[model samples]
Target: MTVSVAALIVASPALAQEVQPVPAPEPSQVPLIRMAPAEDEQVEEPQDQGEDGEPASTELPPEPVVAIPQEWAPVPTTPEGRSAYGYYLAGRSALASGDTQQGAVLLQQANRLTPEQPRLREQAFTAAILAGDLKFAAGIVPDAPGVSPTITEAGQLIRGIETYLADGARKANRLLAERPVEMPHDRAATYAQVWIAAEAGDWNRALAAPPADFDPISTLVARSNRARLLEIRRRYEEAENEWKELTAHAVAGSLFRLGYGEFLERRRRGEEALALYTAAIQAGQAEPRIYLAQQRVMNKQRPPATLRYREGVAMSLRTAADQMVAQNANEFAAVYLRLSQQISPNAQTQAYIGQTLINGNLPGAGRAVLAEIPPSEGPLYANARAQRGMSFDKSGMNEEALAEFKLAAEAAPDDAPIVYALANMLIKMERFEEALEILNGPLLNTADQIYEVRFMRGAALEAVGRRAEAEAELNAALALQPNEPSALNYLGYLWVESGERVDEGIALIQRALAADPEDGHYLDSLGWGYFKSGKPEQALEPIEKAVAKEPANAEINDHLGDVYWALGRQKEAGFQWQRVLTLDVDDKRRAEVEAKLKDRLNQLPYDRVAPAVVPATQP
Candidate 1:
């Protein structure tokens, strides 16, 4: 679901207005770095030619520098250029420090100073939209349209909302039909139009023929919208069939199930709703939302009335945001969600907004929204705590992460995800036995993530020296997921080192390597397996490649050093061993590598060095 933006746009759980604003500093005094895209993922722009070798965009480029005033927030009465520079710098600092709300304010001020800076205005617009202030972003384009066409769509959409409220549905429909949103974003406009038309008591738009170039995802979303519209059209038979078809779609399966069940509930079909929810749970789709739906049904509560215009728009944006989030366009998703929240303030939307902020690395803002979900909210409250725990863990606050995870787990003992999260954190801190206690607990015995549970149990058992049980668990996990490379590589590595089945272990790792040839950990396992089998010549190449794949990995480096020593390259081995010490090696590995550096090995150590996977493995 697309989260409502700005539900967490504050720096804390308190209202946004409660925070004191920072004043702009002197331009020369402010030293800030240029903001880079998240994850350093390069987004290529149109050059002389587009990707298909077509001519550059038909739209006119941004003009020469022209300062545009921002009406969203007050700007200091200083020189436009100077204030823009200072506020821009300060905004960059705030964003870097995870204060999204403050950064949005400062960036908004900066844009007011110099909106003609295409990149600068775009950045400010993004921050504003992400803060769930789409109207503010929309305001930027009137003075400086070149800053963003994306926000131009936002402008029209919000205006349509205003028109719908002030005038009537017919006039609003006319205005909304002028959606100039281009491709990629065109679908969002199309969906929004459907909702607005419905409010005008029209179903033609919902059942209309697709545009010639309408995308597949948009088509599917439209069809989902059609299902609901069919019901409104008094075509219950057709609506039921559409619901079945939609719920059967692989991608739409569980996602649409909730909507379908809700539809059933709204029609007063409680038994059908319960059956649907029960079947989903039995099939291992035991999500918190499903359980919540089940609880509501049991209590004989009525579902909400049929979709209103605003509600439909919110749902459309949310569904679009879901696709965007899936594609790692979380920042864009936040924009859609923020607008959705403005139209309708649902807790689900708030949760999604928090998640998008967290995914976008604006964790402080995420925590602000999540903190508002009180304990009385059940699954949502647990999810809020769990999301906060993830943010804490990412910031290296390990203790806080564990505490939050514990709380989430306590609240949802039968919830597999929460339980797994708590266990994973314990395992990260090397509290393996504690992890084992939870993994072995009743919560996940019949859970959806059974394969993952089995694999984790195997690893935890191995850590505590229960090799036989560990192997059994690993085998059982493989039985559940026969092609799972992680289990294959890990068990294979273990078997190779333990001298029980050398060739078989090598083959197992080889099989795992087939899944993803360039995976650093799998490469390391294959190399280490060869080394353990006394074929240093075979080990040399893969180990070197593994080091190249994970240059800063201490364990991979240590493995490379051992391979070098086995192959009689003592000097290079010593150099690699020295390099390992400079990496994030633990005390035990430090001692091992240091000893290997001091004593040139005449032979490879018979004792196995546990690979990184034993703990730091990615499934």
Candidate 2:
């Protein structure tokens, strides 16, 4: 169950670089920094030779050095300013250390103490927003004039959101329109206008033609908002037409289908609703609501009442989150996702939030979010557990990860993804037999991931000395995915080492090298193959290159030593063998290498050329 070198090498093509003569040094010993030329030094251009051979012009004058003022105030003259400065420093330190909550609190204190300080107020506001304390951010908007334009716009947006939440759509709309807070590209302001119009029951005004400058996403949002309003108002025919037009576009994701399904279900078209829900699921939608709706339709029961307004809001937020994710604004995306979750509380939203947290390097927070997914969401709960297991595995908590994976496997026994995850964990833990059993039993029938299952099974079989079965499984994997590098490398190396199908093995390894010429491990395999085929001369260059690329690799070093021994370089052979012993090799390999060093040469099973004679003086 040990992860093979093939597995590691196959995952990264950069590992396959051609070995050069000079050994690659360890990272710590490599000189990475380049010294820059001194600032005051000037480069002299070459001059034409004079008739008397007097070389160049006179030296240029040295640049004058300006004196910089280094003096500063020894102490703050005012007590309040001193306290505020102290709090600012502490708050910035906390924020730099990733304690956003504590930083926000401290910065807010500093802002309160220095009410006239625009920078302090802005820092406190930004920290609060990043900490997801929108209310606090809104409350702390500086009343002082002449603040930064960016901060002012942010303050306006925050106040607008607060008004929307506290006093409903009409007041929020009036406030935003009056203030006219301009965002870059006006995305936020445009969206707010559309949603507020819809919420205010001005369907005609809301459905009026979108502005000429609206981007595709904003246009989609506006149209979808209109369709949703129509659906809510029971204008079924117009709603269906609008939805049909919207969903025809590729950007209309699963949310569109879900909305359409809700529309169909409310109109007593159960079959249509069920079909739409099924289509959504097939399109990779994992929202629990779709599944629940399908179940209700299947049972001939009426679906739950649609929360059209809330759904519209959640969809808008989710769309914004998607855009944010695309732009690599992970923290902002997480905030938008959380806002969407508050409105909808669906499994997909929860999953997005958890994964976003993980991507933002908050694995513990991600796992916590996944763990809170309720059991009532059957498939989603299983998926969440699987996600949680991956988070734990990534964080190096193996036993906890195993526990989570097992729980997920039990909950969704037929799920290929969960089964694969569990099998991978088992393999990593050296539970090869259990891993083989899982892959050979339930996963054998999984059509979607059959190739992966076969590949893993091949590796497991190879680990347990069932070489024939392993070969067969690898061949099957290749049949499923032709030229699959991992399978090709493993099978080719095995064939060459075993002295079976030597020609085919050489060809297979060549094909793999063709695909990834830089792979050092594959180069090693090709070199070994040549040596075993009684071509030590041909084997020398590749083996030398392999060793240079993977300077400390025990297996490659041993191969290099064998090649060297065959070529009559006994002393160099001994050096390579000794180097192998110093590496983290297994006990069996260590003993074999030690024996090779002591005996000067060992009888290898494969055919090789006789060692060349060396003079006694050649030390």
Candidate 3:
């Protein structure tokens, strides 16, 4: 039931452009509300730029406004003594501008200066929620001065939002249970009940809440919540329909479409997914979740699309951009990344920018971006090291790439994922002994990584020609995850190669293909399944699909060559084998492909073929 790529790609672009953008106020206009200054002021003006060497004005700047005391607006401050008011204004401005770090800092300073200031305290509460620092928001919610019961109630509602974000609704619901009916924060109390019921897997309670009254901007939030609730209940068809409704009814400038787009992507509607994602990107609503989501979709496509949007953007912008990308619009992620870089200079962004460049088929550009961070010491350094290793490996510098992997492995010794990466890299270098040591030692001991360790151990053994050991390890992995596709394909393909249990191996590959219908590697496995069964003609379709999905995969291209040769298509077979030789295949495989190409060329008749060779396209 997979939708053809041709149908998805041909959809109208105008329909995609209809989703709304996220609303943002002009940069120069600061929303000002007053809070009274304490008699003892300990205000510290935010310095122009901190020692981190990032941009100073990338976040909110400080400003002054009128002071309010005892929950009422006080007289405006004189020019000479406005630092306290300035801190409050600056903090709120920072929060509104999506600069949570600066907002947090400024709000902290303002809270210290005016402990009894309700407006200042409320702003602090809002900042914590927006920053996703639930613990901080919880602390602030209990102790604020009641300056008008409504403001205090708003504070209480945020407390529920924080609790929901942190401990899920179970704890939040228990907390609300102790409150009396006359509690000052009923609205927040009601919302907490809704959140708790939904999180506790009770969709009926969540749906029973009064219809949400949201401003244009907040309406997006409401719709997203509704969509999530429906998704949680496993009402997928209904959820899809809700998303469709939201797409049509959501305001043109609303950010809710990111979530809807993601729903389409998860359903494997790639064309619709990509279109919605691109709309969000073009509307300047690129979020980090969107980028990651879109990347997942692209990875599942016939021809893998680049996932580099918002790679170097501010964390907030990156988050938003990722959300949009996740909704499936990876092509515009670059805009968010570049904008984040322009706003702030940080190693995290640099690493992302480099990775994005690599995904875009610009390994040289990736290296150039990474080179800017001389003597890398942070997360960006590790990221740059990984990218540099891939670049070196691609350029035929296996030893150099191994050194980089070693550095990355040493830097994050306890991280099982990094260990797996290093072990995989070692296998590629044909250093199977070293790979075996790493996987059998550290990776095996790590919790939750046992399956991956066992899988890699099998690969290492197979690379070193330890056939019996490889089979045992792969069999053990299958016992843990019976339908694990990588293990299934690898073990099945190995059996095919050895001409043992040919029918069983072919069935295994077909089952793997069913699980991951669009995966290029799995497609190649299925094609090889046909070849092993002596059905060369039957292998052609899957082989062609595999090549279409992963143009740069050396092994898939070689498999295609084998299929062509079996079909007596000598010219195409030679071209494919030559293409494999041009890629960064392992030394042994490279030599084998070269030998196969030469053997086939010699068998061709002198006058039957044209003199000039056809341009070879590799996997």
Candidate 4:
């Protein structure tokens, strides 16, 4: 199951005091997940990050893999089945390429030809919804046990929403009320009632009792929902009280802060909103979202909340999309997203739906959605451009990726996060001078810089051969955030490689390893530290284990070869060095690897591998 709405309305810090750690997932799911720098980990509400940034050495994770099927089932052999199979294959290809309109057409044709195949119909219905053909999807909606499309929840909800747009609220509420009052359907129906009643100008029913029990996640959303409705209904006191309770308890600088502050601004309480944003910033919530909110208020916004009933219903649909997308079957969220768009087209919704499609591996559909956003939506357009860069990177179109990032940076030059992101892509592409210039630029050269800025700048400096400067920057980063494992690993490895503070470097790497035992980079750093400290004997085991964990890593393999050679395993060392040449090493590393294989090798006396021994470096 997806934790959608819950992901959005996070339990406040106080509510989250008794946090339970999630259990580890299987290693198969971690197919190469990070970028070279911290900015790659952009926190988008909850899921914004470069999905294609990780090295293959990074152990694949299983969590985000969720329950998506990989291979398709075989099609039947009858005449209609074969024709439908061809159309299905073509439609799937079209969808993968981001041509949802044609894809939906082809998929619907396949379903028509293969009416008995439930899966085909499901695919067609999904494509139709994603293509914004809601009525068509609703007409052919399947009745499954889950939101994959049960009439009790998703199906009835979609149908009712369509009805409200066509036949009005009374008729829609009648249909919505008929859905089985089960767990999810009960909640969906309750939300539907409020929106429908609001449309009919019935405040009593609109502010009815809780959908079910008041769980933390639902309660937060429910309070937010009730407060918004209250304000819309001109019940000012109740709305203000509700906002107070939420602001007091919300996770610092969350979207709730944004929502509440926006509400205050619209109510002509600009000073109060400014105070809220200021408090959030002073409380160590320096996120751009809060800064943007403060900027909006200072510019003198208009007074009092004024939105039509349709707009209210559209906002509720956006909320429902957030909830549904958090589930494992996130593709279904597009149903709600498209429906919301049909009612009220906005850049925020388009960006969100676009991102959802991209993250869910529907890059074609995602790119198409993102492309539809007008450039007039300043920051939103810039973000969409960045996402396009990510999509390009994932597709191996490196030039296109960099170009898109450049466009984003140019468009939002003052947006610190976007600047950092462009620099990140440059660093990854070995365009270090360009990246260093950006890092050293005025926008990022502030005194109280975040750890990411410091660490990434250190990395860029190191790449451009500024040794002492890199170390000092990394030290500044370390001082800013002492327990950050990535910073520790990078600085430790830098020192180990340059023969500076080797012993202390070993300790730092050990700390990094302790923080994340499965990190291949940390393991390699530990082994390299041992070798640099003149104990190749101590280096063998961790290096070997590191190789096992990341067999495809050129650097780790090179380290293993050096360890093997020092221990009299000369033949194996030569084999390892030869293998490094075939892996994706840099040109400089390739030259060194070639020299090692040719001039420096003669087999030694050792005929077998030595027994493993634990290094003192183990934490």
* The candidate that achieves the highest TM-score relative to the unseen native structure: 4
Kindly report which residue stretches of model 4 are placed more than 4 angstroms away from their true locations once superposed.
1-85, 113-117, 143-152, 179-186, 201-207, 213-302, 324-329, 391-397, 482-485, 499-511, 514-518, 600-619
lDDT of 3 by residue, 536-587 (tens): 8998899899999998889999999998988889889988887786676888
RMSD of each: 12.0, 13.5, 22.2, 12.4
Could you tell which candidate, 2 or 4, scores higher by TM-score? 4
- Candidate 3, which ten residues in sequence have the lowest lDDT sum? 1-10
Give the candidates in order of TM-score, highest first: 4, 1, 2, 3
TM-score of 1: 0.69
Q: Per-residue lDDT of 65-166 in model 4, one digit per residue for the tens? A: 122123346543345455665677788777766798788888888777666555456677767776778787778875532222232245566687788888
- Please report the candidate that would top lDDT against the real structure: 1
Clashing pairs in 1: 2-318, 5-337, 5-338
Q: By lDDT, highest first, what's the ranking?
A: 1, 4, 2, 3
Please give the CA lDDT of all the candidate structures: 0.73, 0.69, 0.60, 0.72
The global Cα lDDT (0 to 1) of model 4 is 0.72
lDDT of 2: 0.69
